[model samples]
Target: MNSRAAQLQAFDRLLTIMDELREQCPWDKKQTMQTLRHLTIEETYELGDAILDNDLEEIKKELGDVLLHIVFYAKIGSEAKSFDIADVANEICKKLIHRHPHIYGDVKVKDEADVKRNWENIKLREGKKSVLEGVPKSLPALVKANRIQEKVAGVGFDWEEPHQVFEKLREELAEFQQEVKSNHKERMEAEFGDVLFSMINYARFLDINPENALERTNKKFMERFQYVERKAKDIGKSLQEMTLAEMDVFWEEAKTMDKRF
Candidate 1:
């Protein structure tokens, strides 16, 4: 039965540790946002891996690592007389209160979709000229495509139905195939991108998150591949020596397993 105050105290202790590191550790003191940028991205991916693996303990540890980075940045900002962690927290707090007007104010939202629509509208009112303004340009292409589609959808630009999106996906795929036949690498890449974008739109129409959907497929592929490896080992054969027919046996077996979900 931990209280909110106890959690705040724990966070304060973490902030204190970050401050000590910044003051006494040469490496920590010498670091800047530019230096830590890649490390932050790596930590974020590690956190994503932990989440996908459904490892709660690992997620907690990775979250602490990310939190430490937040405090570390805040400590550096404090030294430069810019801002502190409190200001960062307060800013987000105010933003959440403003965004979730259904809870904080008298605004009514019918459902989660309505909440999302309101959130985007509020962001626009807060001075974002375009719905896509907040999506990072450096995001992975698949993720960026999904976010871009979602952002555009928030502003009322989207496909009417999943079936229509599916047809567009097929059209893109056909165009990509034609580009491949003509050996036009650039056009092939563009058409392939269009296919992926259309598929993401279809997923959105079906109320699915493209990122989560792809992550699930990634996990499934890993499990199935591992099954193939294990089957090969049990048969005293190496994967390199196994034929496609032999691998297909284990692949199908893996599909039959209930643990895939």
Candidate 2:
């Protein structure tokens, strides 16, 4: 078989297995969309974590888990007479053909930016009230901010220079500092949020994903903390027994080790 035929066969096999499991397996038979929603989210995050770690094997496993959730949801929808796997797949296929007019039709795009602009324009033509309407409210704030900024930029609303973003960042930071000095808890919280928003916007100006960058820092801190904990154990000292100066010695060593990694 050709590669495409082989892929179809593989997908068919998964479908067959899904049907059998739904009918025969007690746990699989019992699952509903509501019960599986959190699992789907967790699987997506695992896929993201795998990508961040550069672990292709884990990514593959996580992807399979996510795919299973997709099929499972389709199965449930079929049971409700709403939709099925073929409907799900064909709807996306239709969307791809609709969105990529440069390839599927005569629409000319100059570059990737043009392609992105076309995509947002297409969404608008498809009857979306606002570009931001497509963004899920459940998305984490950092990711949501990035999406909002990108959506606006797609329609030509953005700062022209990174220096302009830097100016905004400095202003937000100064406001936050003033709030800190004033010691007004509610205003301080609001100013702190403004600081974070400005920082995320500046990071976007520099082509940095704030969410990914923060997650990477979180992982680095986790690894360095584990290293410190191990060293403390070797010296028969709990973290509580160690002074800040002593922990700094291990923290510095961990930094050196991190460079090697």
Q: TM-scores for all candidates?
A: 0.89, 0.97
Worst 10 residues of 2 by lDDT: 1-10
TM-score, candidate 1, is 0.89
Error of 2 at 157 (Å): 1.3
lDDT tens per residue, model 2, 129-234: 9989989999998899889989988988889999999999999999999999999999999999888888898999898989889999999999999999999999
What does candidate 1's lDDT look like per residue over 1-261, in tens digits? 679999989988888788788879989989998899899999999999899889999999999889888888888788889998889999999999999999999999898878888989999999998888999989998889889888888767877778888998899999999999999889888888888888888888888988888898988899889989998999999999989998998999999884555
Q: lDDT of all predictions, in order shown?
A: 0.88, 0.93
